[model samples]
Target: MADQLLLKVRTDFVERVTKPVISGLLDDLLDQKVLQLDEVDEVQDRYTVRADKARCLIDTVRLKGTKASQIFIDSLKKRDGTLAEQLGLVAQQGPPGDQLPPPEPSVGIQGQQQWIQQCSLSEYQRIRDKEGDQLPHKKDPLHPRTAESCLSLSSQIYPIHLPRETRTRRALIICNIEFEHLSWRKGAEADVGGMTELLEGLGYVVDIHCNLTSQGMAVVMKDFADRKEHCTSDSTFLVFMSHGVRAGLCGIESGDETTDILSLDTIYETFNNKNCRALLGKPKVVIIQSCRGGKVGSVLMSDSKDPAVPAPIATDSTPAGLEDDAMFEVHLESDFATLHSSTPDTASWRHPKKGSVFIQRLIEQFRNHACNSDLQEIFRKIQYSFGQFPRQLPSQERSTMLRKFYLFPGH
Candidate 1:
C-alpha cells in the first residue's frame, strides 16, 4: 500500500476551504431564523453572528457522528482542485488537454478514503477554533434582568424620539428695568425685547413681565411651574434681567436701607421634580443676565487726545415651592440648568444702546449654532465670546440629567 502520509495544507488554504462551506451553512441558518449575522467580511473569512445564535451553530456542528462536518468536507471535494489551486494548496492543474499519467496500483481506494478523513478533521478543527472565539463571553457582572430593567427605565425617562412641538414651548421672561430708588437699567428693555424675539423664533411662547417686585416674581414662578402645559413640553426656559447683588437678584423693593431679594436656591427647588412633577425629566433652562456684584469691569485706554469719560455699570439678582399634600406622590428632580451672566462677586457689562454683553453674545451664538449643537455647547461659545472683556465670565450649574438636552431650534 502507498505510504499513509498526512497532506499538510497551508493555514490560508484551510481558511479558504471553509469560507464557502460556512457561508452556505449560515445562509441555511438565516433562512430558518436560527441565527442573525450583524456583519460579515467575506474577504477576511469572518462574520459576526448574534450571541445566542452562535452557540446554537456550535452545538449543532459538535454533535457526535455529526454529518455537518462531513458535508463541509464533501463540498470542498466537489470543487475538485479549483479551490486548492486558488489558495496554492496543491500544484496548479496542467494546461487544458494535457494527458496525465495513470495512477499506480499501490494507490488504493482505502488510502484515498483515509486522506479524505484527514482533510475532514483538519477542516473541522479550524472551524471549531474560529467559531469558539466568536462565542459571547460571560464576564459581565450585571444580570440580564437588571440590565434590561435599567434600559427600559432610561428609555421611559428620556425619550429623545418625541417630536419637538412648538405649541408646547413655554418661557417666563422677567425684566426689571425700573427700580424703586436704584438707577434704572439703561438697556434692560432692549435685553427683554431681544430675548423675547430670540425665544419666540426658537418656538417658545414667552410670557413677558416687566417691573416685578420680589413677591410678584415668586407668585409668577409658582404659577408657571404649576401650569399643565409644562407636562407636554420637552423643555422650558426662564430668563430674568435686572440689577443684582452677590446675595441674590435685587427686586424693585431692594434699596439702600435694606435688601429685598429672592434666594437662588429657592428658585431652583421650586421647579425641581419634588415641587413640580409636570416638568419632571424635562430640561429647565434658567438664564440670568444681571450684575452679580457691586464691582465694575474696566478696560485700559490707548493714548489719545479725547478726554476720559465715566462708563455706566450694570448689576445682578428667585424662589418658590409647592405645598405638601398627602395624595400627591413625590418624584425625584433632574435636568435643571442655570446660566448666570457673571461669575460670583463680579459685575456683568452692558451697553446703553445695545444689550448686556452676556445676552447679546448668547442670542448670536444660539442663532448660529442651535440647529447643530446642544445647549451646553452653545453656552460655551457664548462664554468664549465674552473673553475679550475683563471681569465678565458666565457660569453654569446643572442637576442630574438622564440624557443630553438639545434646543433643536426652528424645529
Candidate 2:
C-alpha cells in the first residue's frame, strides 16, 4: 500500500459523498408524507402521524417559498374545523362592517409612548439625585406612578410595521486567515458567499464583506450598531471563520502587540448593545471555526464498537493513523495558536482557500435543515450536524453560548 494515502479530498469530492446520503434522507421523509397538514396548529407544532408530511411541507416551502404555504392552506379547505370556522367567521364579517367605528387616531408612531414613559422614569431618578425629593412634579406626556396616573396597554403589537420593501435579516461571517503570509487556506470569501446564498434562498437580503483588516472589522461592526439603532432587521446572525489562538481570533497585523487580535467581548458588544435594539429579543447566530489547543491523537474512531484487533501499527509517514472521516483535523494542533499570537521574531501567515471546514459544514446544514424552521431551528440543525461530524480541535474549542434568543417559536 502507498505510504501516503489521499484520504482527504477537495470540495467537489466531498459533495459527491454527501449528496447521496442527504438525498436518501429527504426521499425517506417525502415517502412518509411529512408535508401534509390537517389543521392550522399542525402547521407549527406538528402532529405525530403527519410529522413526515409536515417536514415535507417545510422542506418544500424552504425550496419554493410561500407558495407552499398557500398550497398547504388549500389542502385544508375540505375539513370544517377550527381553521375552517375562523375562515367562515371572516367571510361572514365581509369586507366592510356595519357602519364601522372611525379608525382611532394613530398614536404618533408605535411604542413611542412606552419609550417616552421609560425615559421619564430615568429622568426622574436623575432629578432626585441632583436635588431633594421636594422638587414639584411637572405635568408631562408621560405620567408618573402617582395616585392619579397609570400606563395603558397600547393596541399596537409592534412599534413599527416593517415595510415589505425592507429586508429584515442580520447575519455575520468572521474569517481568520491563519497563514495570510503563505496564502494557503483563506476561507472568508467562500464562507461569505455560501452563507449569503443560503440566507437569500430562505428569503433574506444579505450583506457581505471579505478580507477585513482588524481596524476594518471594527468599522464594519460600528455600521452594524447603527443598523440595530434604526431597526434594520428583526433577526440577527453572526458567523466567524478565522485564524485564532487559544485566547481568541487573530488580526491582520500579527506582529504588533496592539493589533494581535480582538477579543470576543469587543465583537459581542456591537450587536448586544441595549440602545441599538434592532436585534433585541431576536435570534443571534454565531459560528466560530478555528483550531483550539489540544494534542492530535494518532487515530480518531468513527463510532466504532469493535475492540482493538490485530491491525498494523502505522508510522507517522503515512496518513492512516486516525480513522476519523472528518477532514478538518490537521496534524499540527498549535499551528493555529502560533498564527494568532506569533512569536516575537516570526511573521504571520494568512492564506486564502475555498472555505473553512466548519463553515462548509454549517452552510450544508443550513441548506438541509433551515427549510421552513426559524433561526433557532437552524441552530438546532447546526448543533446536530456538528455532533454527527465532530471536528478535531483543542480540548478548549470555542463552544456556543447564545443568550436569551427568540425565533418563530416565540422564545
Candidate 3:
C-alpha cells in the first residue's frame, strides 16, 4: 500500500523533492537495509539529473514492497517534514504495527527511530486500488490529459483550499495589428490564433480584444483585473501584441514619435496586490509581443523560397514602447512575470505571413514543453532560442512569483 501511495505521487515527488533529501533517503534506506549498497550507488552515480536521482531512489524502494516503502516515507517525515506534509504523508501515515524490516547489519537507534514514528498516527490513511496503468480518464476539458499536477509546483503558492469545482482560470489577449494610421501587422492574426488555442487548451476562458487605444487598453486591463471570476481563479495570463516604442506600447492611432501609449508601469500597478486583491498571491503571467523601437528594424522572411517570390517583407515596429522604469506603486508588486518580445529599445522581427518571431517560437515552445516544464523554464527556452538569431532577443522583464509555475496542460 505504501508503494501504491508512492506510485500515485511519483511525478509530483520527483519534481519537488530536493537533491539533499534524495541523498539522506538513500543513507536511511541503506542503514535499514531497504536498499542494497549497489542500488543506492546506482541512484547516485547512474542518474545525472537531481530529479532523475529522486525517481530512481523512489522506484528502488517501492520494489522492496510495503515494509521498505513505509520506511522510506517515514524517514521522509524526519528528514524533510515540510515535503512530507505536502505529500499528505504526515496525515495519511499507516498503522504503527507495520514496522520497518530488521536491519541487515546492526545500526544505531537513530535509523530505527526515523521510521519508528510511522506507527504513531491517530487517523488511518485510506488505500484505494487504482484500476490500472491505463487510467480511465474521460477527457476533462479543465484538466485535459492526466498530466502532472501543480501541487509539485508548490504547496504554498498554489491554493489547496480552492478545489477544481471552484476554480475558473482566465486569460486575456490584446493584439493591436490594424493600427489606425500605421501599417497593418501582416501576420499578427497567426499569433493571436495560436496563443488563444494554447490558453484555451490550458482551460482558461480567454478574452480576446483587437485594436484598442491606450485608454481603451487601460479600461480592459482594469476590468479584467477586477472581475469576479478571479475571486475563484487559481492564476491568470495577459498577452499584449502591438507596435511599440521606448516609452510604452502604441495604441491603434499611435505611430512612431507619438505619446498614445499604454505604459508598462500602468499594467504593473493594475495587477499589484494593493490594486488587485483577488490575484494578490497568485501568478499573473504577462506577455508583451511588440517592437520596443525601430533601431534593429524589421525582417520579413517568406515561408516559400522561390526565385519569383519577393524579398522578406515585415517587422513588428510601427509605433512603439518598451519596459518602463520602476514606479513606487508597482515596485513591490508580487506574483508577476512579464516577458517582453525584444530587449528594451530594440525592434522584434516578424514573418509577414507567419507571425512575430518571438510569438511563433513561444507558441512552439509552450505546445511542446508546457506539459512538463515550469513556466519560467519554458520562458528561458524561448529566450535561449533567440541566441542563434542575431536580430532580436526576448527579455524576461520582471518576475516576482513565490514559486515555480507549471501550466500542467491538459491537467
Candidate 4:
C-alpha cells in the first residue's frame, strides 16, 4: 500500500522534490538499510538533472516494498511538511502535542539545482585537415542517450545503467606539452582544449593539470583518487597526453633528458581498489595519448583483400542485482578500461597544429557516437579508424569492466 501510495504520487514527487530533500532522504534511507551503497551511488551518479534524480530515488525506494516507502514518506513529511502534506503524507505518529513545535511553514526552500557547474562543450578543430578525411566533421548537438531496460554482457545481465543526470560527473586530464628541457608538444594545446570540451559535454568537470613531471603525475593521480566527488560519480575518465617510453609516460620530460617518468603500473596501482576506495566497483576509464616507443606501430599487414571485422560481442542474458551485494567480496580491481595511443614498442603520430592523431580521433568518435554507443564500443570505433593509417594503432588493454558503459552525452 505504501509503495502504491508512492507510485501514485510519483509525478508530483518528481515535480516538487528539491535537492536538499533528496540528499537528506538518501542518507536516512541508506542508514535504514532500505538502500545499499551502490544503489545510492546509482541514484546520485547516474543522472545529472535534479528531477531525474528524484524520479529514480522514489522508484528505487518504492520497489523495496511498503516499509521502505513508508520510511521515505515519513522522511519527506519531516523534511518538507508542506510538500509532504500536498502528497497526502501524514507522519504516522501525528505531529507531537505541543511537545514539539508545529511543523514550520515549508522552509519554502525555493527549489534550486544542487550541483551548479555550468559547462559548454567545445568544438573539435583538426589541423591540416586531411583533404579527404571525414573526421573533425561539422559539429552536431549532443542529445540525451537513454539506457535500455537491461544490458547483457559476458553471460551476465549487468544492466547498462541509465544516464538520467546526476550531481557529480567528473573527469581528470593531465596534458604535458611544455617541458623545461624537452621541445614543446607543439599542438598539444589543441588536444587539451578538445578533450576538455568533449568531456565537459559528457557531464564531467574536467580537472586539468599541465606540464607535470613523473613524480608530479603520481601526486596528481593520488589526489584525484582521493577526491570526494567520486562518491557521486558512476564512472570516471582519466586522460594523459605527453611523450612516453615503453616503460611508461615520459612526464613533461624527454628520453635521457630528465629522470621524470610516471610508470604505467603506478597509474593503475594508484586507482586500484585498495588505493581508490571511492571508485571501487565503478567504471574507471583511462585514455593515454602518448607514444609507447620510437618504432613504427604497423607490423604484419594483411595481404589478403578480405576486410577485417571485429569479433562479435556477446549478448546479455542472465539477470543480475542492482549492484554487487554489499556482503559479497568483489574483485580487488575490476571495471577498468585503458586505451593506449600506440601499441607497445611503437610510435604514435600527430600533426603540429592538430595534436595527437589519437586525441583528434577521440574527439571525433566520442562526439559522434557516445550519445548512442557504450564506452567500450566507442573505443572500438577509434581503434578501427586507425586501421588504414599504418603509422600507429591505439590498443585497448588492462580492461576488466563487467558492464557496458553508456555516457548518455546531453542529459
The models' CA-based lDDT, in order, is 0.56, 0.37, 0.69, 0.67
Q: Write the per-residue lDDT of candidate 2 for residues 14-82, one digit (tens) a residue.
A: 223232332333344344453433422433333222322333233343333333333322333232234
- Which ranges in model 2 have alpha carbons more than 4 Å from their true place? 1-164, 176-184, 228-232, 255-259, 294-354, 372-377, 387-390, 393-411
lDDT of 1 by residue, 330-368 (tens): 334467767888776667777775768788888888767
Give the TM-score comparing model 2 with the true structure, all chains together: 0.41
Q: Judge candidate 1 at residue 136 and give its lDDT.
A: 29
Candidate 4 segments whose C-alpha is farther than 4 A from its true place: 1-165, 253-257, 295-330
Give residue 60's lDDT in candidate 1 (0 to 100): 32
* Cα error of candidate 1 at position 253, Å: 1.7
- Per-residue lDDT of 156-271 in model 4, one digit per residue for the tens? 21222344354476688887765656556667766766776566556666776666678878987998999997887777899998876666776655444465767787887888
RMSD of each: 29.3, 21.8, 23.8, 20.5
Error of 2 at 30 (Å): 51
**Candidate 1 Cα deviation (angstroms), residue 200:** 1.1
- Per-residue lDDT for 311 in model 4? 28
How many clashing residue pairs are found in candidate 4?
5
Query: Residue-pair clashes per candidate, as listed?
Result: 6, 35, 9, 5
Relative to the true structure, candidate 3 reaches a TM of 0.55
What does candidate 3's lDDT look like per residue over 224-327, in tens digits? Answer: 99898888887999999887765577787785465577888888888889889988778899999876654423367321111131223343453433344345
